[model samples]
Structure formats: C-alpha cells, structure tokens
Target: LQEYGLVSYHSLNLLKTQALALGLPPADLRSIKARYSFAWNDQGIKYLGITLPGKFEDIVSTNHKKVFAETKSLLLRWRLVRLSWLGRAAAVKMTILPKLLYVFRMLPVPVPKPLLNVVHRDISSYIWNGKRPRIPFKVLSAPLEDEGLKFPQILAYHKAAAIASLSESLLIHQPLWTYIQSIALPGHSFPGLLFTPSKSRPPLPTALQITRWSQNVMTNTYSPGPMPHNTVGGS
Candidate 1:
C-alpha cells in the first residue's frame, strides 16, 4: 500500500512540482483563437474549415449566440414565474449558459481505439498515396504528444470536433439530450480550481506534515528489535 501510494500518486506529485516551477498563480495563456482570427490564412488551411471562427468568443458571437439568446429568454420566463424562490441562483448559474457552452466546446471527446485507428489509416493513405512526395516526418511528427500525429491546427480541430460530435452522438444514441444535463459544468468547486501553487500547502485541511520521520518511525517500530536479546547468547 505504501509503495502504491507513492507511484500511484506520481502524477499528483508531478503536477505539484510543475505548478511550483511555474510559480504562483500559474501562467496560462487563455487561447485567443475563439474570439479573434489568427493572422494565418485561415481559408488556406482547408482542414481547419470544419471549425472556423474558432476562438472562444467567436462561437458565442456567431454560432452559439442564437442558442444562448433563446435559452436566456426561456430561463428568464422561468425566473419570472418563480423569482421569489430561485431568481438569484438562476441568474448566477443560468446566466453563464453561453459561457458554459463555449467551455464545453473545448472538451476532448474519447475516441474508441478501433475507430481512431481507422482514421489514422485513412489520413496516412490520403497523404502517402498522393503523386507528390510525402509530407516530411517533421510535419507528421508535429504533435508527438497527441495520438493522431497531426499538426496543432488539426489536433485542435479534432479535439473540438470530437467534443461536438460526441455531444451530438450521445444524443443520437439516447435521443432526448437528457443525458447532457448530467455532464459536469465548470464551477469553483472543481478539483482543478482547488489547486494552488505546488509549494504551498492548502489551508483548508488541518496542517498534516508529510515527513521522513513518520516513515523512519514506522520502519523502526515494525522491525525485529535486537534479535530478541539472544536467549542463549549464541545461535
């Protein structure tokens, strides 16, 4: 169990180390892709077509605005009916529906192994079968960390598309979109939010010091003590 505790929790420790190295209030560059168009020739990137206006704000301004507006109106009506009971909570939570939609738009979908393999084979065939020389390994190896071995743009598009497609797919499988309601929405209570700079211990839990002393004490106490004082003074 102790060994399991160390290795099993390596990632947790790694994340802490990374967070500490990053210093306090970790630096994150909120991608501006959603609200603003990149200088790159977006039209030239044919693969990115499926996800144009890709910035977080661009979706709300263009794609999700209609859904948000309609839902806001409907929620407003619902609030009017029960304002005395749930107005404030509804206003705080429901008002962020559009933002929630934008964030959900970023979730990566879980692609099954067989289907993803097929897609990889398809992409490889499409690239390698062309009459021209194949794209160099440098291009193909751009996203080594990601499974698809696609360029960043393609990776982002696939991730976003996976989220979009899966959300729709779940509805297709279940119909009624009822299951979507259970999906977690971002909140202060999320585990990611509770995270602080790695070097600092969180104040909420009582101060529990993790130290070598405990391990030393455990090892010494559990070990056989001085061979039980040698009954006959010999083996």
Candidate 2:
C-alpha cells in the first residue's frame, strides 16, 4: 500500500520498518514518531485523539450535550451547502456546451455594430457585469420567469431556454412593439396638455419612448380658462 501511496495500517508498518532498518538518525526518528501520532485539528483546536496521554473524553464532561448538538448542526449545514453546490455545478457542466450553442444562434447572423453593442451592453449590464456571473441559460429565462433576485454565478437551464427562445423568436416583435409605443399616448388629455404614453400605448412601454419625451411634456393640465364672470345681470 505504501508503494502505491495508499494510506493504511500496512503502509505505515512498512515505512516504519524500512526507516528503522536504515538506522535513521535520532532526529529523523523523532520526526517519524511524531507523524505516527493520530491527531485531528479543527480551526486551532488540536486533539491527539489516539496518541495523547488523555483524550478529550477524559478531560471534558460528556454531559454537556448541547455543544455536541451545535457541532452536529453546524456540520450538517456545511454538508448541505457543499452538496448543493456540487449538484448545481454538475448540472451546469452537462448543459453548458449545448446551451451555449443556442445562445450563439440567438446572436444576430449579420450582427450590426450598434445592435451588438446594445445586446452586449444589456447582457453585460443585466447579466454579466454583476458580482454574480449569470449562467447563459439563466440569463435567457430571468426576464421571462420573473426571478426577481439573481445570483451572478448560478443560472438554471430553463432560464437559458427562455433567453434562447426570446432571441430566436420573441425578439421578432420588438420593432413593431416599439413602433406602437412611439406613436400612441394614454388616456384623455387635460384641456391644454397632450396624451401621456401609458393608457394609449401597448400593454407595455419601451424605455426609448419614455426617454424621448420630457416629464413636463407628459404632465396633465387643468382647464385653460376660469369660471365665466357674471356681467351685472346679463351682457
């Protein structure tokens, strides 16, 4: 076992025997002896579980059950987090290559500089440039699935699907949708003012349309004239 680097009782015995046979110096022997003592270190707490003269069981009272419970709870929590990460990473690895192909397909065939810039900027701003890196799949789904809070690192497969679908098919209506927002305004206007984009626009408004009009232009107006004056019994 020692020859193959397996840690086992047989390997330890073989190494010890060979060291003794070589007539290793006293200092080396002491180092070798130290290594044989089985110990466990947690944070800074060291326990010579087997080799020390007294074990923790002998010094610490076993009746303090709460400490053991806390330790177990902490250990279980750590394991749960570790296992969750492992599972998520494994799933990501399996889907990443295929999903990336879809995202690339979503990319415009003859990508324009400005449009690419917009896509890159939106993807970077909403998806990439944050502390958490978005998984490609997750980036696709986020706006659709309505996942409010997002972590940069982990993205789900369904989300990538959403992004892919949006890229391939959903974005087709973007131009028409935007055209509608630009031409229409919402609700009845006040006596002096024009329409605001809410009531008249589509079910939604584009960021651009809102940006084109100033807030003052969108404000509601009261009646332009005051009540008619009474001209001393009738004019």
Candidate 3:
C-alpha cells in the first residue's frame, strides 16, 4: 500500500536522499512544496484548518476575518426568511457561535481586544437585524431560567477554551504539544511558572497567554487574596 506524508527537514538534498532510500518516487519528492522560515513568498501550510508557523496574532486575525465574512453571509441569507427574535437568537447560538468556537478551541490563543469588540458588534447587529436592541447583551447571554435567551458569550467561551488547554498541559502525563512547549520554557517547570511573578516568567508567548487567562479565571471566580502555597522541601 502506498502512503504519503509531509517531511520536514533542514536540508533538501538530505531529505531527497532519505526519501529515495525509503522507496519514495523522485517525481513525488520533486513535486512537494516545501515551506520553511526563510521562504519569502510562502505562507505557512494549512493543516486541520489552521495556518501554522505564522505570528499568532496574524493567524487569529485571519481566522476572525474568515469567520466574520462567513457569519455575515449566513445572516444575509437568513434575513430573507421571517424568523422571530428568539429564533434569530437560536440561529446565532447554533450556527454563528460554533464557527468561532471551533477556531477558539483549535488555536487557544488570545483574541485581540479590538477584534473581539468588532466581533461583539457584528454579532449584535446580526442578531438584532440592524435595529435598536430592546434587550441588553448581558441579559440576553444569561440562562433561560433567568429570563434570557441564553446567547453565547464569545469572549467567555474563548477564555474557557484557553484555560482548558492550559489545564491539559498540567496533567501528569503531559501531551506532546506541552512537552514541545516546555523546550521553549527552559529551567522552569509549568507549576513553578504558575507561581512565578509575571515579570519573572519565561518569555514564551503561549505560557504567558495561558497564565494570564488562568489568572483572569481565578479573579472572576473568587475574591481577591494572596494565593496560598505549600513548600514541601527546602531549596
């Protein structure tokens, strides 16, 4: 059976030689489009719907644009049908938010404040059908038992996904991605870094982003106080 996979290597000549040794056809090797840090014209490759190796901010921005465009197009089509406000809210929850939520879970990066503001505004406009809103967004986002529509809160969802990703990394059997990220975090353990001051933490973006997110989760969920710590052994 013939199987194909992406090959990443530091040298094209070495890669070609290895591929030839593995019985891969020379023609297939020649046809492969290679991307690397130095490729001026090559954007990152897309895998599982994400464009990799690009600036995190740029990737999040691109995702937001695509999601926004798709959402607007969907809302435009839905406008042709006579849906009530509750129906429209349900559509937004069912259709629109899921798209962004997928991106949120996949990327697990902080969405820029301006982009978030734009998303909230666009969702508001789409849900209200360009009319003045009769209900406040906060009330709309509350549960139905609280006399609300149970609208999805985009920012809150994003934060939850990021915090979940961070928690996953802390598991005793760390994931491959967590192990890879630890290389960037040299000398400091993940738990140790959690207790470290913001200025003292390593300069890894994902670590810092997740730390801030975890802090935000704690701040919102509890009263402010110095976090208690236990030292097991003397250093």
**Reference-based TM-score of each model:** 0.21, 0.15, 0.67
Ranking by lDDT: 3, 1, 2
Which regions in candidate 3 have their CA more than 4 angstroms from the true location?
A: 1-41, 53-57, 195-235
lDDT tens digits by residue: candidate 3, 10-116: 33433223111122376753455242222222344465776554344576657766776777777878888887888888888888888888888887766676777
The clash count for each model shown is 4, 9, 0
Q: Per-residue lDDT of 1-235 in model 1, one digit per residue for the tens?
A: 3476688874333222211111113233224333333333322222211233433234424433343355445544554443422233234334443343343354232233454343333333333432353555355456657543433232334344433433343343554432332233223221221122222322322111111122222222233336554221121
Best-matching candidate per TM-score: 3
List model 2 lDDT by residue over 1-235, tens digit each.
Answer: 4555565434454433322213458697578668754332221222322111122232212212222234334333433343343353343335432333343333211222353343333333332323355455444434535753232222233233323332322243454533443355355222112222334333334432322232222222122234454221121
Compared to the true structure, candidate 3 yields what TM-score?
A: 0.67
Per-candidate RMSD, Å: 27.8, 30.1, 8.4
Q: What C-alpha lDDT do the candidate models reach, one value each?
A: 0.34, 0.33, 0.64
Model 2 spans with C-alpha error above 4 angstroms: 1-84, 90-174, 186-235
Q: Against the hidden true structure, what lDDT does model 1 obtain?
A: 0.34
